[model samples]
Target: MRVGLTGGIASGKSTVSAILRDLGAVVVDADLIAREVVERGTPGLAAVVEAFGDQVLTPEGDLDRAALGAVVFADPDARRRLESIVHPLVHQRGAELEAAAPAGALVVHDIPLLAEGDRAGSFDEVVVVDVPTEVQVERMVRDRGWTREEAEARIAAQAGREERLAIATRVLDNTGTPEELRRAVEELHAELAARP
Candidate 1:
């Protein structure tokens, strides 16, 4: 079975994904593949340079992620242009990994932008990890060191909770401890496993 695990910023999708991994599902992470595609000598980096110019690169010749982030997040056109270069490569790599998984294996694809990108219905099932907006802000402050404005900006950029839940086959409420969260994953894993 193929399921997509998604949520807004600071919604604990990675934490839930770790639990799912422990339960024996093959997890394909799009962000990880994105990094792979843009490694030092890859063609992806070349495309990024062509699109955004060498100013986005570091003195060490690798991608200066902070610099690139500042550019795109400030300009929608810049972000879209970069996404045009990166998303296709990321999706292609995802398909390759999905194809290579053992037959009938349960796979969890963790895509952070599934809803905003119009990909919510692409999976056999969609699992949303949710928490209160305030708690999400707190996490962004504590875990990610994001300023309040920065956190709010990212939240504003994503699909709203109602939109995400409207498409979900299952919802993982993540307003509890790690142990409680793991229990949720275990329960969901068992439920999916029980499905014929």
Candidate 2:
């Protein structure tokens, strides 16, 4: 089965994806592949540097993610331009990973932005890691050292709770302890493996 796992920023999607991985599902992570295709000399990084200029780079010459983010988040046109540059490359690599998984193994593609409508339909099943908005803000602050305002801004950039959970074939509520989350994922793994 091709499963799409998604969630908002700091919503514990990666933790759930890891649990799925330990159960032997082949996970094709979009963020990991995005970083690979954009590493320094690649065409992706070169395109980003050309479009955004040296101001988007650190003194050490690496891409300064914060600088590039400030531009994209502040300007819709700029954001679209950045997405245009990165998404195709990321999607291509993700597809290759999924295609290369063993014939009988389940492939789980964990894409952070899958709730944006059209993106969710590609997979046979969709899973979303959900938590309360306040809990999300708290976790981001405590774990990521993000201020309340910054945490809210990052959350605002993604689909709201309604949009996220509305598409879920399985919703893993991660508001409690880690053990609870593990139990939920274990249940899901068994259920998914049994499906034709």
Candidate 3:
């Protein structure tokens, strides 16, 4: 099964992805791929520089994510422009990884923007890690050390909670303890693995 796993920032999606990985799922992580594609010397980085200019690059010739984030998150047009350059590359790379997975492997694509990108239907199952927006904000503030405003801004940049839930084939409620979340994921794994 090809599973698309997604959730808002700090919604415990990464935790769920890690558990799925431990349980033998072939996980293609889009966030990791996004960073790799934009690393210095790649065509991805070159395109970004050409679009956003050198202000978006670091002194070491790396993509200055914070600087770019500050620009894109605040401007919808800028965000869309960045997406136009990056999304196609990410989708292509993700497809390549998915194709390399062994036959019958439960391939999970951990894409943060699955819903935002309208790509949920591309997967066999879309598993949304659901959490309230407030919980997400609190988690971001406490764990990531981001200010509430920053957390809110990042959240606003993605699809709304309702929008994500609407696309979910299965919703993993993550408003509970870690143990509870783990148990839920294990159950989900068993269920998916049982599919023939």
* Tens digit per residue, CA lDDT, model 2, 92-192: 99888888898878889999988864778888899999998999899999999989998988788778999999899889999889999999999999989
The Cα local distance difference test for each model comes to 0.88, 0.89, 0.95
- TM per candidate comes to 0.95, 0.95, 0.98
TM-score of candidate 3 versus the correct structure, residues matched by position: 0.98
Instruction: Encode model 1's per-residue lDDT on 13-127: one tens digit a residue.
Output: 9999888988989999988988999988889999999998999899987998989988988887888898888888998999899999998888899988788687766788999
Instruction: Give the worst 10-residue stretch by lDDT in candidate 1.
Output: 113-122
The C-alpha stretches of model 3 lying farther than 4 A from their native spots are none
Best by TM-score: 3
Against the hidden true structure, what lDDT does model 3 obtain?
A: 0.95
- Per-residue error for 117 in candidate 2, Å, reads 5.3
Task: Score residue 63 of candidate 3 by CA lDDT.
Answer: 98
Give me the runs in candidate 2 sitting further than 4 Å from their true place. Answer: none
Better of 1 and 3 by TM-score: 3
Provide the lowest-lDDT 10-residue window in model 3. Answer: 115-124
User: What residue pairs are clashing in model 3?
Assistant: none
